[model samples]
Every structure is written in C-alpha cells, then in structure tokens.
Target: MAALDEIQTIVILMQENRSFDHMLGHLSLEGLLPDVDGLRQEDMELTTYANEYRNRFYWPFLIQDEASVIRDPPHSRHLVQVQMARSSSGKKFRMSGFVDSYIQYTQHQTEHPPPMGYFDSRGAWMTSFLARQYCVCDRWFTPLPSDTQPNRCMAFTGTTLIDDTDSRLIPHREHVFDWLNARGVRWRVYHDGPPFFLLFGRFHELVGMKYRPFSELAHDIQHEDPGQAPQVIFLEPRYFDFFWSDEPANCNHPLALVCHGERLLHRVYTALTCNPEKWARTLFIHTYDEHGGFFDHVPPLPIENPPPPGADFTEGFKTTGPRVPGLLVSPWVQPGKAFHGNLDHTSMLQLLAEKFGSGPEDYSASVNHRRAQRIRSLSEALADAPALRPIPTRAPEPCPPMPSMKRQPRAPNERAFQKAALELLQHEGPIATAAKYPDLVGAPLTP
Candidate 1:
C-alpha cells in the first residue's frame, strides 16, 4: 500500500503481437534469467517440446540477424485453436499444431517455419536487460486465445464484444478514458505515430490534449510542474501498418524488425530516467497484446468468464490466452525479481482502483470478479524492500535498417488502423491533426 502511494505516476508501453516463449523463452535457455519459466535445454534438444508437422518434428531454433526475414504467423481465433490442439482429455494442449497451423494458413508447406523460432538475450536485448534488472511477471497471460482486437479490448474495457480483428471502431460499454475522466484521474497517451486508441470513438477531441505524440513525453517528464504531470501515461509504438510509408514497425508485430520495438523501449526508459525525481516515483510496465501465433508450451488457464452481453462470440472466453512477456520497472521494485503470480491485462485496472478508488473491486465488478478468481494487481510487482537507488542507464546498440516492401500489404488490422487514421483526420481536419500528430500525415485513408 505504501509503495502504491509513493509512486505518483504509472506509464504503460504495450507492444503488439509477440509471445512469451518466442521473445523471452531464450532468456532461460541462455542462462540469463534462469529462474524464469522460459525455454529449457531439454525443450530444444528433446521431442518433449517439439511440434510435429507432416512427418517432420521441429524444435525451437535460434532466429538470427534480428529475424527480419521472418514472416507474420497466423493468430486468428480459429487458427489459434488449431495451434492449441488440446489433448484428447481436454485438460491440456499438445501444442503440436503450431507448424501445421502455419503451413495450413499461409500455405507454406515447404518454407521455413516462423512460429517455432525464438530470440536469445542479445537478440531481444532491451527486454532481456530490463527483465534481468527489475521484476518480470512470468505468469501474466492475454485474456483470450485470439488476436489483437479482442485481447486489447479486454485490456482497456474489461470485456470484449468481438473475438477477432475488424476494420472498425471497437464497441465498448465504457472506455478506460471515460472511467478515468469521471473519477478525475489525470492521464495521457504518447504515440510514435497514430495512437492506437483512435480505434475508439471521440479520438479526435482526445488527440489534441489527452493524446499527444511521442515528441512531448520527455519534455513533460522533465519540464512540467511535478504536481501537474499526468498520473498515468500510455505509450503507443509505430504499428506495423505505418511502416509502409512511415517509420519501421516499432510495436514488434509479426513481420516487423523486433529491434524497432527494442529501440522504443530504450527511448521510453531514457525519457523517464531523464527526470530523476519523477523517476523515483514512476512505475513503467512493458507487455505485449498477444502471442501472434508463436509457439508456447504452456496451455491457457481455464477461467471461464461469460462474454459481454452482445458479444459476437456467443460463448464467453473459456481460458486465458498463451503467455506474453511482462516487465515491471520502478525504483521501488526489487532488482532481479521474477514474480510468478497469475495475472492478466485486467490486473492493471485493479491496480488503478487500489491506488485511486475504493479498493480492488472499484475498477469494476467484472474486473473484481476476475480478482476473486485469482487475478492479481501490479502492486505485487512493487517491492517494499530496498531498491536500486541510482537507476542504471546505458543505451543499447541501434537496430538495423528496417526491411522494405514493394507495396502496401492487405492485413485487416492494417486497414483498421488506416481507417482510424482517416477518421482522426476527418474529425480534427488535416491541418489541426497535422499540428497535433505530425506522424499521422500520410496514414492511408482506405483499406
């Protein structure tokens, strides 16, 4: 409780589409984070962790050169189900369908598979460094075994109406921003390009003040009156859709150079540490939206929660999605800690309620229900023990130049982002939007 009060600011940076085993599994395999529930030597050498496709068995292999040549893996609801391929007993997943699912969806029977590839410490330098230096929530999972839209909706709105990505504004009973505003919580969003929240209604009005570009984050952290600074801030990376005409995909979505997201992590950390007093009181969290169809040996936990009243998926979510990487950064956090608590995205809202509202249940009854079912708050990541006083700050090697494509691709999520950018431009007028978010200038207006 004291840790929550001493910390005056909480910043969240949620990247896209990478999974726990694919990104950080190698951490344990390489002896860096030996305690983490990551890849093991046996998993790589034996058939126990192998996935069978056709007559061939595949094990996790090192993805070298930052894996720029790797293609996006299929992560839709049905495909994810295929990837799980639960054992006959229905109590566990064989996790053997990943290679098959990839070949089936992409029709790349002869091509090198991407889902079984994993990155080592040097490959995922930024994430590994933070994990080694602070606390890593090893058991955190995405709320559903699906793709971006539904999991993200679960993160921000406590519930989702759809189970897959669609090219439209996400319908939510209430947005987190509305909840924050009603309770008078000061919050802000900083984006490298177009803010992801534009997918929700009222994005235009929010863009100018509540939603600002990445450029202003450092300034606000260093120069703004300490009391006037936002209590919470969300940092949105350059999504994959923006890189066709803009910068590299910094959110680490499939097909993106993972280094871009690493570089983004460096930038946000640097900005926060640039202000020592603020840094002392700030808590920065880093996590991914979903697994992006990567291979994970762990099966989803069975925690049944009925879907929203009008959800497209009539049946509620039966289990949590595959694990995603989660990091907790704060001066109050014990260094070299690995928290194994069972947590999900809704835990963030519960943390907020503990800090600002009545108690654990103040976030919402839905979130409180999940709490009753054993979902924990971020507060657990904060330590009451002595902490690292002088926060280490060393910049990492620059990422390689992003690979180029001949033309824009036709991913549905990309089109949805394009639509959101267009709606923002239409609502605020190009001139005003340009002044507010210069990065959205060339955002595609059509699918």
Candidate 2:
C-alpha cells in the first residue's frame, strides 16, 4: 500500500445524475484517449423498441451542445427494474429495457426519450480534460440501486437504511464526519448554496461550523495557514429548486443547463491547482451520486453484504447501481490512465479508513462489517505514481445565456433529496436562515 502521507488534502466534488457512458463514453471516438472503455460504433447504433409503433428507435448519436435534457427519465425503484430489464427470478439483468421504461413513465407521450441519448466528449469538455489529464475509472458504480439520498448516505455512512428518496429527514446513522472528528482528521464542506450535509440532521452542529460558502473556498486556499487548512473538503454545487433565485444551478440536475456545471468544474480546478505546492499534495475526485435514469450497458455486480439483517433488506442492496463517471485528479496520477477496478461510493469510506484509522467501531457495527467485506479502497490508484508539476489548463468556455424561468409544476420525478433540502430551512435558526435565503415565501411549494 502507498503511504497516506503522500497526499495531504483530498477534495470531492459530486455532481448529479449522469452515467459514465452518457458523459464520457465518446472519449475514444473523439481521439482524446485510446484505451478508455467508451462507446463503439456498434454501441452507438444499438436500438430499443417502443410499443407506440413497435418502432425501432436507433440510439441517437452523442448530443454535444444541448444544455438541459429534453425529458427527465424515471429512476425510482420500480422503474429501475424496468430500465435494467431485471428478470422476475432476480438473477439476470438483460440491460435492454430502457426505452420501454421511458415510454411507460411518460405514458407514451414523448415520442423521443432523452434517456436514450448520450453525450460525446465535446458535450463535457471539462470532464474529458480531467480524465485525459488524470485517471478515469470505468467500473465505478453507485452503492445502491436507488436514487440520490440513499446513494449519498452510503457515501457518507457505509449504509442507507432507507431504501427510497422520500421527502423526509434522513434518520440518524454513523457518519464519516463523526469518524473524522474522533480521529482528529480535519474536514470541511463548502457549498454555493445549501450544503447537502444538512440533510442528515444528526451532524447539524458539525455542518454549521465546518460548512462555509463556496466563495470562501478560494480565499481559504490562498490565505489560510497551511497547517490550519482542512484535510478533506467536499464541494457542493448550487442545486436548482422551483423558488426564484439569482444563482443558476450548476449541479447538473436534469432540469438545469450543464454549461453552469462546466464553469463550476473550471472554478474548482483553477482554485486548487493555482498553487503548485498545494496542488502537488492534493488529490481531487469528481463523480456523480447515481446514474439518474440514464442508459448504461454494463450490469452492476452483486455484493456479498447487503444492508444489515433488518433495515429494508426486501430490495437488498446486494448489487451496485449503474455506472457513473469517476475521475481522480492529481499531479501524481499518470495522464491518460484508466483504472478498471470495481469501485462504489463506499470505496471512498474504505480509503478514508485506511488513511485515517476507522473510528467508533460500535457506531454502526453491521454496516461497518459490510463495508469491510465489499468496498474496494481507491488508494490503490495512487500507488507507484510519481508526482509531477501542475499542468496548465485552458479556461472553461463562458456559460450560455440563462433560460427564462416559467411558473411550472415541480418535476414529478424530482428526488426527495431536493424536498428534504427545502424542509431543512423551515426550522428557525442561524442555519435555517443561511440555507433559505431570498425567501421562498411566495413561491408555490409544489411548483
């Protein structure tokens, strides 16, 4: 194993709802890199049948310039089964039912479903640049076969006791923050708006002190005493809600334009790499929480350990969800390298446990045991890699003009994560005020 001392800071930026193939599968086609497990000519030409006309719909070639997707695909538990074409026996995943699932979800209203679409490297230049310059993991999957909240919970704590994305506060569970705190490992959550950590109320005090506005991140990087800087930093992109606000969401939710996200990646990369000394000692990771109902050809593997014996074992999380983009950025990584190891959200926890000793074993014994047996630590990627000087990166293109917001109903498929986020603000406190700025008092809650 490589010495943890080589890397001083670890930064994670998790965006929303994009599959690996959806975003970066065209890297090879674009001549960016040759060995990446990306889309092939046959893959691009595959078709799925829709019942409407018994029509054979050819998979659309990569869409390079579109900002927001035309339609949000359904990703709820029931829909995922349809998307994967999971057999009734639960032993086979045919990976052939996406188009049919989309049609059913939209009630056959949309003749063309966006889930069948993909993006070439041109659509996600920043991601491609990072993957080309560092390492791209093609086999990374989300921990659970569910939506945002549970998968995110798995990233934070080694379990998601809850199975679905219902609009409610997350139940208290052992979190990585508690582990880091016990071991004296410094960490911080930086956000452009409401930090997602607020969703887990158990760590409210920790979130309050460690959570800082994204604006302060650059300043902290430049001015803070090296010894005082946080060892682990999580950057939360601004999330889009129905409420009127000046900041356009950059989290890349299906409804928001992706250009904003590209600019965000630029901001984060520039700030972290500006200082050579800091850049050399830092390792930044970029990934998505889940595939967000996108089409992925590879079937997720089954895990030996499911969530403990009791909590929602009915739809056991034995198998990981669809593949999502995972990039490891650092001066140490070899350019154009692609790691094919099996990794999921808990792999991060495994890495943290290795770097800083695992904390409070009794906090969630079953979950911890399951994590130990299943998740693969990502530290292996850093092994035997020689550190190099920071490479210069081009400035991200300017964002497209903002689209007009219209009074509309809240997306029917909107994740409960967003609703819980807004609910976090209903409480009367300093945290509440900071989270719920530009009051949404007049805005219709459903819209």
Candidate 3:
C-alpha cells in the first residue's frame, strides 16, 4: 500500500442527474444497450407509482412498495400540464419553461414514464468513465429526498437538508474544509455564474476555500497556468451551455455530458501531467449530485446513516432516498474495479475524510448510525511511482464547437418558436436557438 503521506491533492467533479442503472446498467455487457428488449427500449426506464405499466419495467428486486411505484421526486406534473395548455390555447411551447413546464415536471413526484432524453443511456457514460478511470461502491447513494442542492450539501458536509424551505440555506456543520484549513490543504470551486457564496452565504468560508467561475478556470488552465492548482477542485458543468438537452435536459445527455466530462478530466490529466511533481499525488473524482428521475431496477435499502440531523435544516434530519453514481480517478484506486459495497452519500464523505486524515467528527462524526467505511488510497493500482500518465488533454471547447450550439435550425415557416424549438429538440439534438431570450425563445410564436 502506498503511504498516505505520499498523497497531496484531490479533485472532485460532480455533475447532475442519472442513477447507477440509468447510466451504467448494461455497461458491463457489450452491444446490450443498443439491443431491443420489447417495449423497454433495450435501455433503462425510471419507475413511477402512478403507472403500473411503467413501474413493471424496472429491476423488480430493488422495488419494495408494490402499490407505491417509485417515482423520481420533484415530479413532472407542471411540465405535462403546461404542454397541454399550450396545445389547446393555440400557443407554442413557452419560453418561460422553468415556471410553466420544465421545472414543474422535473421538481414533482410523479409515476414513472419512458426515459426522457436527458436519461436515455447514461449507463454508457458511467461505464466508460469507470472503465477509463476507477469505479467505487456500486451501491453508493444520495442523502436527501430533494434534488441537487440538498444532495450537494450532504456530499460536502455529510449532513441532511440545509434548509427545508430553500436548498440554498448553508449548513454550519464542520466539513472536509474545516480539516483542510487546519492541515493547510488548499482548494476551490470553479463555477460558471454567480459565486457560490450568493446561494450559500456564510458557508463561503468552506465553499470559497477556492471559488471561481468556469470561464475563469478555463482562462487559468489555458493562460494563467497557476503554478499550483487548488488541492481540492470542484468543477460544476455549465448548466445550459455544456449539459444542454431538449427534453428538459435531465441527466442522460451522454453525448454532451460525457463529452464535457471527458474534456474536463482531460484538462485535469493535463495539468497533472504537465507538472508531474504536483500531479503524481493528486486524485480526481467525477460523480453525480443525485439521480434525476430515471429508471433503476435496484431497490435502495434505507441505510442507517444520518447526517448532523437538523444541523443543516430541521433538527432530527435524516437521509431518505436512493443511490447516485460516482467515478474515482486516481493511481491509488483499483483501475476499472466495480466496488459493489453498499454506500450512501456519507460513505463517500467518510472515505475522503479518512484518506486525508480528516477527523471523523468533521464528517460522519456529527451523524448517528453505522459509521461508513473509509476507502483506502488506490496507489498500488499503478506499477511505478504514482505519476500522472501521459494522456491526451482536450482543452475547453469554444461555444460554437459545443454540441448544444450546433442544433439544427427550425424550418423557416414554423410558427410559435416552442413548436419549432420542441420539434427541433431531442435526446441529443444540437442547442440552436435564434431567440436569445429564455422566455421569448421557447414560447409559441403563434397567437
């Protein structure tokens, strides 16, 4: 085993949506994802409680409630209702997609339906990511009943909801950052829009350990070339720009998501390779914040893990949800090994804390339950000194080069841009919109 003292840096990349099966189910099998399986699209499908037909398609083993079909929380009712409204009112798809349709459908708890484009075949991406990097804990899970915000907070702090009303509410629990500060480990979060502080306030000390917009990161990697990158870097995909998709862009947009993810990893690989002295000990991790309502056959058992309950939100908080997928890329991890050990969000935080010698109290400590097992460094996976492999580094792609920008244009005569836009949009279509305004662009152009 490589000595722990040899490790110096850790980098984390957390994307949105996608469950394990939705993204990695058939990965182990060749030509399976492309094969047909009756009405089941040869691919994975999200389960729903409202529809018996939909729920029947998932892994029967994972599901426990026969009548209460599993539906991804934050349902899609608002989305469907809005679409029906536009059809009868002789209106086009609304540009105010967030309020009218998209967000509502994505944010509610409804029955399972066919795989939305965003979730088409994320398994391909997950499999590829694991085969190319490292796979840990197949049973890894999320820590909340909600989506991105809460799950993300749990990841960083191993706690429950930050705010019952607003996910933006930052938790005060001591996190991995606290340990880093004491140990003098440096870090930062590269974003694309507002600083994380705006949404997370006082937690800035933890989040801001290193904070910069995605664009800023691009500039630094290409131009500034900071002699030393942050010890721990969190790279968030540019929401609309890099992860764009038509069907409300859930989590499955593998072409865009995987492409962007690979490109980003390539950069990290490059940074490490260019400066072997620094990269040799660095570890890069790429994973999802939560599974957007896609299908998963594996029923998630409620693990006894608890975060600093109510420490972030209401007192007595507990994690109640399913698993999310993750990829660990480093010399220390067993390359291409799929760890099927049962785990939850706290499990990951627990592993990281232990790897860096961060006290358990900083993470799993405040929580109550079976303490998650820490993952040991995977340095032995490499034959020689843990050096960054000489791999090709694809740089940050330009706007025009992005698949989202290459969407086919609407027919010249199509009215109600929504009709035109919706028609033009698909699972992996390009993201081309003449209309720059979010509201005006997607609304029906017709009267």
Candidate 4:
C-alpha cells in the first residue's frame, strides 16, 4: 500500500441542519468573532426569546409546552415557520426563516413540527470538528431553495432540485459515484441505517453501498486497507426524538455544541491518522445539508436563471433561510482560515467533479460551463503544510459507540408527528420537498 500522504481519497461527512454563524459564532478559539463586534454585528439575536422563557428557546414552539407535546396541530406547521422566522429575525434575509416556516409556505397549510433543536445540535458535532482541524468556509451557502434531498443532490450531483423533489425519489442523471466508478475509485457510504439517495437506482450502478448500523461503523473501519479502502466515504447520523438513540442518559439532553464537536474530531482523526498510509492524502469535507432555521445574518445569493436540464422544479427559487454552516478539511488548504467566498451546495459537487474528473452534465451546465474564470476551487482551503509524519501508532481507541437506542412503539403524539411528516411528504411529493425546505427555516407538517 502507498503511504497515506500519496493517496488522495476524499471523505465527505454532511449532516442535516445548522447555519454557519449559529454554530461557529461562539467558536472563541478561532477568533472568528467571539463576542458580537462591529463586523460581526450581523449575528442573529440568540437571546430574542431567552428573557420570555428561562429554559433557552433554542427551538421555536408555538405553544409554550412544546417539548412534552408531539401533537402537531393543523396550524402548528404554519406557526412553526412564522415562529422560526421571528426567532431568526436578526438574520439577513426576510425570506430565510426556520424550516417550519418554509414547510408551511410550501405545503400551504399549518402542521406539526419535528424535533429541530435536538437534531441540529447533534449535527453540529461534525461541523465543529472541521472548524477546529481544517479550513472553514464562513461564506459557504446552499444552492437550492430548500431542504435535504436537493441540497444533498447538489453535494453529489452538482445541481439543484432538478430531477426528484423527494430525496427518496431517484434521479435520472449520473452522480459523483458514476465518475468514481468509471475511474475505478473505491468508495463507500457508511450510515446508521439504510443508504440514502447517493445509493439509489441507476446511481448504485456506479458506486458501492453498505449498511453497518451505527454500532458497526468503527469495526468496519478497522478492517480497511489504505489502498483497498474507499476513495470517498460519507457518514450520516440517525435521528429519533431529537436523539440518535433512546438511552435515557443520552436522551434529549442539553450539551455544549463543542462537546459533540470533540467527538466528531476524534472519529475523523482516527480514520485518517490511524492508517499511516491514508492520512496525508485524504481530504475530509464536512458540511450541513441545509440550515434548519437557525438564526444567521447572511442572505442567499441572487440566482436568476432557469432550472437546468433534468430539473423538474420551479425556477427563481429562493431558500429564504439563514446561512447554513460549511467547512472543508484537507492537506492542500490552510489551517485557521475562514473563506468568505460565496458558495452553495453546488460548489461541493463542483469540487468533487473537478477533482475526480467528472463531466459537467451531472451539474448545472450554467455554473460548470463558465469554468474559465468563474469556477472557484476548494484547493485553496487545503492546509498550507502537510500533516506531520510518523502517523501516531496509538492503540485503536474505538470510534465512540452510539448509545443503544430502542425505537419504542410510537407514542400517540409521536405517531402524530410521523403521520404529519409522511402526509407532508406524500402531498409535496419528491420535487416539491426539494424546492421548499432551506436551511434555518422550519416547516410544519400538516394532516
């Protein structure tokens, strides 16, 4: 096997929610703006509702007693968005509200809201890791107007809500996996459950997929060969009751985002650094699918163009949510630097396609076509100096195990939340869902 420095594998870990500023603003270590300053005055007012409620109104709930009640009332969906937008009123764009707000807008009805705060905090763990260890894109944004499926598509396919609105629906165009397959690149998608979109339909023809359950992730990594290991890897967390697991000790507990951050750092550090042959050449990119209605000050860039081919959604789309957080960690990029360049999910696809020699057809031709001077590369995000050698030979401390969780039979209210979400998904279908949900905006599911 070649030395770790010689290999160029890219491992991308994309989580679900959180805007760039909400999570990173408090990162005092980066000096990225510890306390609000003249330039950082654009931060969202995290304390807007703090005085009204002592318990910290991190997630917006229409009724004061939201945590105990899972019942998503008919108006809850609409109100969720309104409340989220209000919560993030300090953020830059008026259109960028919380997820529930957008959900109400897209569904054209009020409905139940899911556990936003719990999921976001968990996802931030991955983002914080990238910030501490690698280069961060402070100005990075999402290209699509709304939520997970389309934004994820942008990461892999380099296009917006073009083919399927629902993430569950498969796309017609080939994805990054196709390019990797054609190049004979070894890659895998590691998830707590079943593989998501990147592994669907014809796309599967191009890449390998595996279901290791959270319990098996580390064990699987132990057996990997530097040369035989996947060239690219993706990690997705499972969400249930604002917690990935149902362990009482770990259930819906409040924690400093940094705590979660440390955990994620340990995982990536081990995955790459442990295998001496894979550390140097590996590029690990961490980002969120969309901002889940967190307050952020930056507004989405104006995209005045028709949706690209194979795209089947409305155009002139605007996410209207606060800025989602993004980070890039690689040997080629500088450390402790914040890139203020304007980027969205499409940029991730652009980066991967270029690095792996994929064609532009997989992405929006408009963005990819203007490669002359317009194309911005993440190579600048690489660390100025390569990671120091003598890859430490520490006894393999196991990847932090996820607390065993039991999906207890859904409670009455929990069932309501799921039903509302399913109905919302069914009504909106795939394409509409992709177009409507943006980071930092909340959407309520309707019955």
Q: Note the Cα lDDT for every prediction shown.
A: 0.83, 0.71, 0.43, 0.46
What's the candidate order when arranged by decreasing TM-score? 1, 2, 4, 3
Query: In candidate 3, what are the lDDT values of residues 95-147, reduced to their tens digit?
Result: 11212233355454333332322222232433354444544445666555445
**Is 1 or 4 the stronger prediction by TM-score?**
1
lDDT of 2 by residue, 222-336 (tens): 7788799999999989775433545677888776777788889989998897777777778898999988888777787686545555565465655778889999888767778
Q: Could you list the CA RMSD of all candidates, in the order they appear?
A: 1.7, 3.5, 13.1, 10.1
In Å, residue 59's CA in model 4 sits off its true spot by 13
TM-score of 1: 0.96
The digit string of per-residue lDDT tens for model 4 on 78-100 reads 33235334324444334334434
lDDT of 1 at 315: 69
Candidates by lDDT, descending order: 1, 2, 4, 3
Misplaced by over 4 Å in model 1 are: 67-69, 110-112, 403-406
Superpose all Cα atoms of candidate 3 onto the true structure and report the RMSD in Å to 1 decimal.
13.1
lDDT tens digits, residues 35-68, model 1? Answer: 8999999667787678888789888878885464
Better of 3 and 4 by lDDT: 4
Of candidate 1, the 10-residue stretch with the lowest lDDT total is 400-409
Largest lDDT belongs to which candidate? Answer: 1
1 against 4, candidate with superior lDDT? 1
- Comparing 2 and 3 by TM-score, which wins? 2
- Worst 10 contiguous positions by lDDT, candidate 4: 247-256
Model 1 / residue 185 / CA error / Å: 0.8
